[model samples]
Target chain A: MHRDGRAFAHKSSSQQELPMSRAYNFAAGPAALPEPVLRQVQAELLEWDGVRASVAEISHRSPEFMRVATEAEADLRRLLSIPGDYAVLFLSGGATTQQALVALNFAAPGQVADYVVSGHWGKVAIKQAKDYVRANVAASGEAGGFRDIPQAAEWKLSKDAAYVHMTANETIHGVEFRPEWGALPETGDVPLVADFSSSIASEPLDVSRYGVVYAGAQKNLGPVGVTVVIVRRDLLERAGQPRADIFNYASHANAGSMLNTPPSFNWYLAGLVFKWMLAEGGVEEFARRSAEKARLLYAAIDGSDGFYRNEVAPGVRSRMNVPFFLRDDALTAAFLAGAKDAGLLALKGHRVLGGIRASLYNAMPVDGVRALADFMQDFRKRHG
Target chain B: MHRDGRAFAHKSSSQQELPMSRAYNFAAGPAALPEPVLRQVQAELLEWDGVRASVAEISHRSPEFMRVATEAEADLRRLLSIPGDYAVLFLSGGATTQQALVALNFAAPGQVADYVVSGHWGKVAIKQAKDYVRANVAASGEAGGFRDIPQAAEWKLSKDAAYVHMTANETIHGVEFRPEWGALPETGDVPLVADFSSSIASEPLDVSRYGVVYAGAQKNLGPVGVTVVIVRRDLLERAGQPRADIFNYASHANAGSMLNTPPSFNWYLAGLVFKWMLAEGGVEEFARRSAEKARLLYAAIDGSDGFYRNEVAPGVRSRMNVPFFLRDDALTAAFLAGAKDAGLLALKGHRVLGGIRASLYNAMPVDGVRALADFMQDFRKRHG
Candidate 1:
């Protein structure tokens, strides 16, 4: 399973094989990418799919770039098995831009929208919605220290809401709501917009259930600059107005997402990532491996008892971001150093959540988690 | 000068290249990029500026990426010799987005805005403003067959006009305006906003002349997904809404253009391009080289008078996008076919304007232009 102690291309490989993980990334958001993906991208950097000039350097209007954009959307649609009615838009500005775009297109100044607040992204969505619509926090789990997503029944949804918004997975806090928690609380055919930024393609997603889904390309899909926006065609017609041209969903759809220049290179890389996902046997394959990785890391933390702890309940913990704390805060410095020396990179907690968090997205192999668990086991034994 | 006759970089090189652009790219917007810059990007695709992961793969929040972003802005400011009172923002969306943003942020409804309709981009600005403000095409060169800019003295500007909008360079029509053509009409104290999308960084610009200088990063700076906006600090305060988050110029300035994720990869690429420009002696060098290239191509057209013709009025033609016509329209196919075989890629003129257009931007070497001129001469001798 370990080829030269590196994760096989079967898992996430956002990086090329270097002697060590470049600076142990862990800076968060744009954290550690898989080494293999990095290598593949680097290998094709100049001549993508055998085209001269790094894909980034070419004209987006070129036939080659058009093909790259076309295939990337096609492959992504195939990997997710997206329905025919859904339109895919490769946009710029990240989830933050999507937050405002969604509200601007769906609800106007007096119209109401629903929000589910669980973590950083959820709060961001609420703040961003204030730009064009009346955003109501239908549910909140913050009082509980963000350890779990609120139960679907607990939401106070708006009967006249234009749409319901939620963060499927919060990167800052390792909390998640499974797909089974299907609570469509809005009345009058309100669209369901999910910010799946950090957790897309990690497991099977019911594309039919979502009215609009967007994920920035950084976390799991590919590199930065490119953002994937999947929206139902019907939603485009009723999208709100005084529609700012750049963020107008209808205008973008009508233009085939070429209202302005698309990031050609980033789009190409995302296409490769989508193809890579398909070749690795799709989402079920992604789930089986991702779960295995999560199970290993969680078991080590749960096994440590008082030595280490993860606050998120077992039922709702994210398979991607796993945040935990050591019993003694003073050992954090020594623990980080020890982990770095071992070559398992970016194993640090987020600033918002003081505990150490290891983000294991679709790319993280079982072996990486196994090593992390092994390292934790040794660290506790030496200092417990 | 020809390092390796047929092949630029080896097929067996560390990275793969895109095969689509087997010949040179001359599309107006995503036109020909410098081969050396493209090659450098390919070599560092896996690792950028010595950082782990392709520059695209690095997180925007990371210090490594931040350094690149800052440097890119610094380099741009340096290249343009921007003043200390202006703010440089790397935004998404192109000049199209800026068309609306400028009007939306700066002017109130019915506030008369003066516009100089030189070509397509100016028309777009006029269209966008019609929905929000009292937009007047104070001056237009359309009657001059869209061949050159009209003198500023002819503008019928309103005394209380909110701002005077103009396109510094029109890509589609191959026209440009010099700052020396800067006499104003009766517009009282209106800030000058210039859309320098096609001409930015190709020549030295007097930064103080315009209140807002916005250009999308695609043509002269970097890839798509990034737009560079330079606005005076004082002008930002004159906007209608400072809190209108997404497209409002004021908030973008207040937020340091990090209002969203900021198209990190594109921004980084822009920085790379900016550094390259600085290394090559900034826009002063670029302008000198551009003039030489334009001269050779125009000379061929002038020398062949009845054989080859350019519609643009001689004195005011663009030094970048050169559109011309062969006397024999029946020979269009033959001319294009021959050019393609000669390694001159994408020489076909824009769809709206039939014949040939060789967009010689900052990146196109004099040799490529010379090759084009020499081919034109030989073709004229054979057919004329």
Candidate 2:
């Protein structure tokens, strides 16, 4: 074993084929990452950019780290085609924390905030903000088992609402607002805030359509520790309710998200993911790939002739998460076990709903989906 | 080049001598780590513990990650010798967020919360909490430029204050309450809350000493993005004020810090650090090393005969951070440049104190301190 400056190069070469052990991981959120990004992270984990220290061990304000912070924001802006009138914040905590902060930062105390609840996470968004705002459920699909998004025309938004909030994708329920479902509600002046935690970067997005867009990086962005919040800069002028400076969005925007020490390592990892996404042709490429992967999996289920079923309305089905059930409940465990044995892992359904779920995020290659589709057919043939 | 499961072993052996590129880092907060920990992280970055995916790319609720979380909490409890009556939370966001939370969880709206201002961070704590509480500065060392801790006897105890808050050590101002400074004031039923961001785990701490102890993991624990909060279990019953469930400490304790998706990668890294600390003899060993390192560096400054100076009172000098100034302000930039060229990095002081600072956290070895002492003398000889 030789120890020299080319140690990373040596390690990379030696581990070139070890990825054979990697399964088709389908765990939702904190899901699969691009192989190239993970390999790059491994190579630089010890000595980053010749700085001779792990990125995690350095000061957030140092010049080396500042460049990382700046470049990440720039890349994300470019990838999403975000406008110059928006402020992007890279913050600690998850999307749930932001659920609370959104109300505190935009609404006056007890001011009405309209919510369009589509699934479990949408209900959670209300739970977090009810303390600071009069969270009004304008429309909901819960009565229909969250199988589809409620039509925007049926929403009863308040005339003086702080903002209209909705979830862009229901991760657990496998429901999404497809372009075929038609345009989102035109809120006139009240800004529309959407939780894009499970689906951001999977397709091209019109940033100007929403007043604010927030996503947890654990899904399509990168890692679990950092969250991205892009808000219209005009919202900074709002005289929001009494809150700590730490929870204030404008404070973070003004400080360039350096209001305090950020999750530097997580931010850097997310940056790597951003770079990878750009190299792979940004959201346009992922959009095409997502359609293909989702099509393959859904086709396998739809063609099973009562052997497999997906309950979500086809028009509103999530392209990211396709949750399906087997013909018999007794065979669920056996199917999951068999899938694991075949090197397709985490196919077990969430306890919230009993059925298998396959999440095809930006990182999940089309080959992985095809493998799962093949495995599903084989499992059904034996059971049939 | 081989692609076997022993890829980690191969990489470790191949990079055995790359420590030559590593400089002695002295940045406060996001600071240095034990090199062995970094190496282990690098080796396992791609595949961890026979799992086909990197730890960061797996579900936090997965059995693999749950085990990691459970073990990390157990190790932290053992390292701190925490009592059964205390609840530990591995929360996202830094200590500043906790500063805001402490008030919302423990103090009634508009209730007084006593604070002892020792340095920059102490003031920051007040700024975060003032909206939720009547933040009263009961004692302060600001009159003397934060060069000493306010004597406990002189503090004005608020009869109905929600809690008494203090910073255990001031990182930027280089002040601490040594044993010789006398015991902290008795607050009776009111719990004492502390910000131990820059000092926790440097030595053994009495878990029962205060009501709540919170520290950002970036400095002495493991990495950025996570904060550790230890609180008396009984205090969880306090109906302090209106707040979201995410900001409620009791909710976090009940859910085992899984109220929302956590910063799993950061938590895993912290667990690794906890293991390393245990293997290196825990807090007892770190305490001994901290004293020796502090003594050596302080001696170099004290012995420089006005070439370099530290103005903090001798009885209150911080063992973790030594902020010193050159006699001639014009030489400050040259001194930092020379130190960097000598492979001693990040000696430049924080903008708040602007001279030069060396942080000697638990991860800093005695040999690193000795080298800094040698460099100090060398620089003084050439410049003086």
Candidate 3:
């Protein structure tokens, strides 16, 4: 029923043209989606899967929607290469809620949980978990304005820590733990939990290395309302603390994440995205495009000869979010307005870091980034 | 861009025909929405409000989206005639999650909370709150199989109860605290909290009467992901319990429900619903339609000489959900299959109470109920 098959025919190429009124959106989270996925959703807005009703209007427990839910988890499992030992949960409340849940589900009441802070999201993770656990900031980059990840030797991990938490990538601060930043420290028996909200599925991930990988499905994933939590099955056995049955991960996992009515429309949209990602050759292909996109954009900023500046250290620059500032900060408003006029939307920086931030998510075509790079050069030539 | 304005023009008239392939869907919650709203969504799936992107693809914090959020709250306030002393919150996670949060936000740790159990959802509220509060079952209809709400005098409220909790309507048991049932008890200084998930806007509501009124948007509202919570402003001062900041209601209220990334797309859809409700004459119009729809279906059931049966007591019978049984239980499969062929869908019963159920929320047109009534009579004539 989709009317636009031609748009997705060449999925990986940087040459595809955007549809009319569809701009190169650079918003972080609640970000852009693949045109083909949006087309499919529009096509089936009235009748879905021969059910004679919209997917959003059907019962989540209906056999028709249960099939949708099952296929989504299966496709996500295949896309991420998640291990069989890991149970995938499609939940609501975004990553912040999951931040609190990780502590309530895995840590004993008032037990110490070590946190390796790298940026704004890392601090948020600690803020959410502190009430449930004795949150210990094992390491922090805040001292340097979160420009880089602290050296692993600087971390003062607790001997009796319940788990070591980290933000895999920070959306606002544009900081990430790249391979060059050094491998995450081995916590021995203590499991490592990472918030991969902005970075999951942007590259191939080693699922077996961590105890829990949770993300709000808004950035590299499809939508904003649903969250995906990949937990090692054994972690479900932890009787961490007294919480409601609705707050229990094991209970949700046992019920196939249908302990209550889920965000079915968001989950279904994520499923469409999963199918698109698989069709575009999964995380491995995304990694290649991501590297290419990041290299091009970083090269443009670095070649500007101080016309533009990105404060993040080169070693840990986020491939997903590239936050940069013009040499004259007063010109920020003109740059954003000019970009919007050029059909580049949501280029304004987040309130936490007020400059220009372009988020290159999986749905962002390589062409979109190229357009942004071209726009940056054009703006620099005009203002320099 | 909407192709069919004709469909919605005669919205309240039973003579209006269903659109092609559109069935009379009766599934509870994640239920059928107004066709006009779906048409608008489909028309704007690619570009929304000149933003050059789908509403789903924009940042919730952006001014474009902030306007949508604010208008939604304002329209809802106008529709419900909510007082200035109330605070409205648009949150993720459904009614079940709020059931847990109510205790964590309003009651002291291990403090007594009174519960009036009318149906399955009431029992669920207690289950979610038992860990955080001293749950006192002040009254229960379980002894009578939840066929009716107990008399107001039968309630045994605690002297120092934090709040009195009740489900405004029972979706599964086909029971409700209808006006004919009786006025609610006066709790002196204690506030009354109600779960209005299945019946919120179906009639004119006295918002000032309840301390907190919460409903998942899936049923009578709009979609499945977002929830609307209205609380008396005075209740925000309670210490409640030590919980994560994300779980705190006061924090969400103070942040304008944008404390983190909200379910923006769902909230926008709900905003569309609010506008439609206002345009179609608000809660007063819905109340008239609900009474008419409920009358037609119940008359068909009662008119049948034992062929169709609804066990809910007439005084407390829900105008929203009508559950019934066929005289010959073995014909259940044939009845459901026949209904599906006749374009009357989701007639299958909830697993909790195994029998056919038809939910007539605000969006379910009176004509759809008339179709179900006619189909029931035709089936009885052929099967009997």
Candidate 4:
């Protein structure tokens, strides 16, 4: 780090030559970027190939920035094997927008939207969309307190529903679907939309499984400014029929996502993360690492004699976030405080779900998991 | 200026004491930010205190980032004299959304709205709103080739209009209205709405004057991801029905702009720019510099007899952007090419408005004008 012409590095490179400065981040979204991606952004921050400005500070309408915009969408398309029938669009606002947007663009006024209330995220989605269109709980797991995914057979499919919406993984509840994509309830061609925010880029996803897919770029992907949406091309054209343009993904896609000024810096960072994901053995390696990280953390929880326990079903345990509680709830705060003193942070659970949560996203290397697991064990010993 | 333990300044900065490294940037939006603000962001890119991360890389939900969001809104309100009756919203999409959003939020289904189409920006606004509701041009300067604002006498106000909309400044067409709280256009008791994208923050306005005012944070404020909207509190709960909640000012305001993961980095950058503006003599000083810079550039054009020209009506000329043309049309490319070689970039005009444009926004120092005028004189001596 350089400040006022002074360079500072905490220490020399490791004995095995591993980079010592990488953060073992466990943030939920904009969570953790690959170490190499951050370095790439730093290198290109001041000047990009003869252009005398940072990519973030440049005009989005400029030719150079345009290259980045298109290349990012292209790379994302290649990574996800996005079908030709789909129009991949980059948007601003998080999944919260999609809750309202999916309803506005897809459903006619007063049409019911079938929502699967799996966890906290789904509840918020349904709450927001209720303002736009009628929301029907086709399925819910609140009976089980979001501890399991609703089986497809359990949903009461609506005859007049415009589409069915589900969150593939709930970061708050730490309940994930067994399959990468959620099971489609039989709805007779009623389009399905999935919020893949927490799970985006963690593994290969079948783009053909749904009519629309949207992800906020905070965890696993990149930073906090942009959202990636891949929607069927047919759905894009349908958006402008009676809907306003800005909220209509088709209008944005038609204009190359420049229907308005974009979140240029975040878009550029997302591109860097996508490039990093591509180079780091693609999603296959990410899936392997993500599963491994989840397994180690869960196994440690299960191995404990009720010192730490997670109620979410095994098949549905999230690969990105794992929420657990100490047997004696009084020890939770001390465990978190001790973990932070040992250089671990954001180990707290969701506000609605009070407990300890270690979000092990794609950026969490095996070493980070070991460190977290080590802290968990140490904290348990100190408190138990 | 240290990249790797060594001091390095771009040759442009090192070559002069003028900080010509801060050249005149005129790419419209995502255009030139204040030089000091850009330097400040670059300085803080890697670490922000004990957080050990760029503000952009932080989670939007974190307590540290929430402070950035809340304080930015507070500072903006103080700077704009925002009324207690109004809600200030920080959104992602630019002023373009406000076009449809204003209609969606204020104009209910089956109701009509009025628009004053002054130039390209207003035209874009008009076109976008027409997609959602029955919007008619209350007035227009299309006959004047969008070179001037319509006189107050010409506005044909609608008696049942939900709100009256206007672009306070036309970025491309080089026209601007004097800062008034926000004046009504012939409609009694009806609210006033203005898209002040190009001219906001240049001066203080009476907040009680308008129902809504919006500006994108590319040129005058900061980076390009977020937008600023100041709306009367009553209007938020009333008329306009939105097709999308993300672009809807009410939803964003209701959520404290944290309804979703915000563009945290851009929000932070905008806050820094606001603080910079406030520190550097507030809105009054910004106005003084803007008027001075625009005056210098216009003087050079108005002084050039048959060599150069600007066609906008003198009284309504934009202090932010000055579009001029050379008498000899063929010299345009050589002029721009020479300007860049001399460190003046993005001075090219919009393709539709051929010739040269020197957007002398708040960030542009008077020195950029002297350099450009000098370059213009040299180019004319050879080509005139």
On residues B1-384, what C-alpha lDDT tens digit does candidate 1 reach at each position? 001122212233323432344455556766555555555555566555545445665556666677677777778889999999999988877778788788877787668898999887788888766766789888998887789778866778878888999988888788888544555444446889999888899989988878889998778775666888999888877746322466677777877787767677667667767876777778999988888988898898898867988988766788878888888899988999898767676677877788988887776777778888888888887888
lDDT of 3 by residue, A1-384 (tens): 112212211122211343446788999989998887888788779877577789999999998889889988999999999999999999999999999999999999999999999999999999999999999999999999999999888899999999999999999999999999988888898999999999999999998999999999999998889999999999999999999999999999999999989999999989888988888899999999999999989998999999999999999999999999998999999999999989888988988889999999998988888888999999998999
Query: Which model is ahead, 2 or 3, in terms of DockQ?
Result: 2
lDDT digits (tens) for residues A1-384 of candidate 4: 011232221122331254223246677766766665655565555555355556655678888789889889888988788899999888887788777788878887778889988898988888777766788999899989999977888788788788889898899999887764355655667878999999988888988889999998888778777888889887765532366567777778888988888888888888877877777778888899888888889988998899999999877888988999999989888887787667576788888889988887776677788888888888777777
Misplaced by over 4 Å in model 4 are A1-23, A180-188, A239-241, B1-22, B131-133, B179-188, B242-248
Q: How well is candidate 2 docked (DockQ)?
A: 0.42
lDDT of 4 by residue, B1-384 (tens): 112222121223332333323345666777766655555555556655356555666677888788777778778877777778888888877788777788778888757778888888888887778766688788899998988777877788888888888888888888888533233444667888899888888877776778888888887776788888888888888746544455566767878887778778888888877776676777888888887777778877887777989999887888888888888889888889998888777888987798988777666666777788888777778887
Please list the residue runs of candidate 1 whose C-alpha ends up more than 4 Å from where it truly belongs after superposition: A1-27, A31-37, A47-52, A179-188, B1-23, B48-51, B179-188, B242-244
Q: How many residue pairs clash in each candidate?
A: 24, 0, 0, 10
Query: Which consecutive 10 residues in model 1 chain B have the weakest lDDT in total?
Result: B1-10
lDDT of 3: 0.91
**Deviation (Å) of A137 in candidate 1:** 1.1
How would you class the docking of model 1?
A: acceptable
Per-residue lDDT tens digits for candidate 1, residues A168-275, read 888878887765455545344877899998889988888878899999878878677778899999888884856546668888888877877776666776776786
Q: How far off is residue B142 in model 2, in Å? A: 0.5
Assess each prediction's global lDDT (C-alpha) against the native: 0.75, 0.89, 0.91, 0.77
Q: What is candidate 4's CAPRI-style docking category based on DockQ?
A: acceptable
DockQ-wise, the better of 3 and 4 is: 3
